[model samples]
Target: MGTSLLILGVALWAGAHFFKRLAPEKRAEIGEAGKGAVAIALLISIVLMVIGYRMAEPVWLWIAPFWMVHVNNLLLFIAFYLFAVSGLKTNLHRRIRHPQLSGFKAWAVGHLLVVGTVQGLILFGGLLAWAVVSVIVINRANRDWARPPEAPMWKEGVAVVGALFLMLVVGQIHGWIGPWPFGGA
Candidate 1:
């Protein structure tokens, strides 16, 4: 069940983004399709999250040390911070051209560390692998790409601070939205 949902989530997410490259014209014409794809991806992603979380109960498929969990938690925290900071008009995104992708990699790696099931490994670990590849591909492709306007210093400062602030709030309420079965409690 978890594997199925994970596959679906990956399909939806990958399919949605992958089409942009294959059918750029169609993608432009059917703006709604992109939105639809994203919406469906999000919905399926939620379902996948639920399944993964439910299966991630205290029961261990294999022995995982408590120290590993601590490390996983730290990685997850960094992942969240990366995701948040990438959203702002910061140097990260401009410099990398794919801050979100980088963040996704971090987030996936963090989760993979915590969850050792094959299904969990396939889902998060697979995504992390993809992110790494995509980052390299995008970087190579855009090595000579044109640059966008630079953001002001004030905006950069605000983005960094705002990212930190958002992390705090998200951490406080993480259990509510996080897929971890034990997150909220």
Candidate 2:
């Protein structure tokens, strides 16, 4: 049941997100109300994902070597930095068309390494797939890419510092609910 909920939640996430792009006419018909509907759907999806992940029984495939934790942490750090790049429109943002989606892929893959369970596979893999598919979908639909205005060099430094801080804070929060990521083997 938990796995089912998790799958359903992931499906809902994809559906809600893709609705705007896939059904522009319908979305336009709904007008401003569509935004609220999508937001509510996203919130429900998140709740289902959290509950499902917490409730699911672990079925381990293979325990990751302790050293992989460091690798995973590095990937997560990169992911966070890329996320910052996406928002800050740093230099990297021009090079990377979809930094946020790339970050999402990294984040999902990082988790996939440490979590060897079926539930982990489903959650992380599903999200990874979603990110990949989203990129393809977006690329196909939008041919022209307009780069955002160049940001000051200082903004890059800010992104770096902000990413580290974000990783620390989010890691701490994760520790409260689940496994402590910092130096935890």
Candidate 3:
């Protein structure tokens, strides 16, 4: 049942996200209420995912080497930085077409490294696939790529600072939820 819920949640997350890109006509037919409906579905999906993952029993697959901890941390840091770049519209945005999804992929990979269970594989792998497909779907929908003007250098600096701040805050939340991310407390 837990596994089923997890699958449903992941599927809903992907479906809800894709609905806008895939079915613009139907979405428009719903008028403004469609946005609210999607938001509600996304929220329910998050709740389902959280409940499902916790309810699912662990089925460990592999034990990560101690060294992978460092790799995971590095990837998470890069993920955070990429998220900041997306929001800040830093110079990196000009090069990376989809910083947000790329960061999401990185985040999923980082979690996959640490979590070696079947549920982890399903959860992270599903999200990773969704992120990858989302990029493709979006790129197909919008062919013309108009790169935004690079933000000022100070914005990049702010992104760096924001990355650091985000890392600390998210790391704290991560630790609270599961293993301590800093040193595996």
Candidate 4:
């Protein structure tokens, strides 16, 4: 059940984002629902993540190389930093229009490499796969989209500060929530 839910969540997240590109009209219709549909989808995804994480049993399906952990952590950190940069209303947003998606892709792949639970594998692996494909498709499709060649220093500073704030939040969650759906203190 938990595995199924996690898969469903992955499907929802991936499908929602992808459909926006594949079927612009349909995506617009859903988007016209005034953010409610988006919010609902996000809510469902969160619930699925929580339930799936909680119900997942820690079983080693495959052994990751020792160096992979450090690499993955670094990737996750970079992902978080990109997400922070994307969230800020800085020139970074102008320079990197899809920083959030890029960040999520990195974060998902990093987790998939280290976290070997069924739910984690399904959710993160599915997302990582989608992210890769989406990047390719979006790049090809939106090649004509204009972009800024460079960002201002203030934007870079905002990205740095935002990353630090987000790092603090992640630490707090790790400490208070006790390692999320998986019991790891």
Best by lDDT: 2
lDDT tens readout by residue for model 3, 1-185? 88889999999999999999999999999989999999999999988888889899999999888888889888988899999999989999999999999999999999899889988998999999999999999999899999989678898888888998999998899888978887756
Clashing pairs in 1: none
Rank by lDDT, highest first.
2, 3, 4, 1
Residue pairs whose backbone atoms clash in candidate 4: none
Give Cα distance to truth, residue 171, candidate 3, Å.
Answer: 0.9
Instruction: Report the Cα lDDT for candidate 3.
Output: 0.91
Question: Candidate 3 versus the native: TM-score?
Answer: 0.97
lDDT string for model 4 (144-180, tens) is 7676556567777877777867766785776576544
Displacement of the residue 146 alpha carbon in candidate 1, Å: 3.4
Q: Report the number of clashing residue pairs per model.
A: 0, 0, 0, 0
In candidate 4, clashing pairs total 0
Candidates' C-alpha lDDT: 0.64, 0.93, 0.91, 0.74
lDDT of 1 by residue, 108-183 (tens): 8767776777767767776787677666766665677554467666766666566567656765676566544223
**TM-score, per-candidate, Cα-based:** 0.71, 0.97, 0.97, 0.80
Residue 127 lDDT (model 2)? 89
**Ten contiguous residues with the weakest lDDT in model 1:** 176-185
* lDDT of each residue in 29-91, candidate 2, tens digit only: 999999999999999998988888888898999899999889899999999999999989999
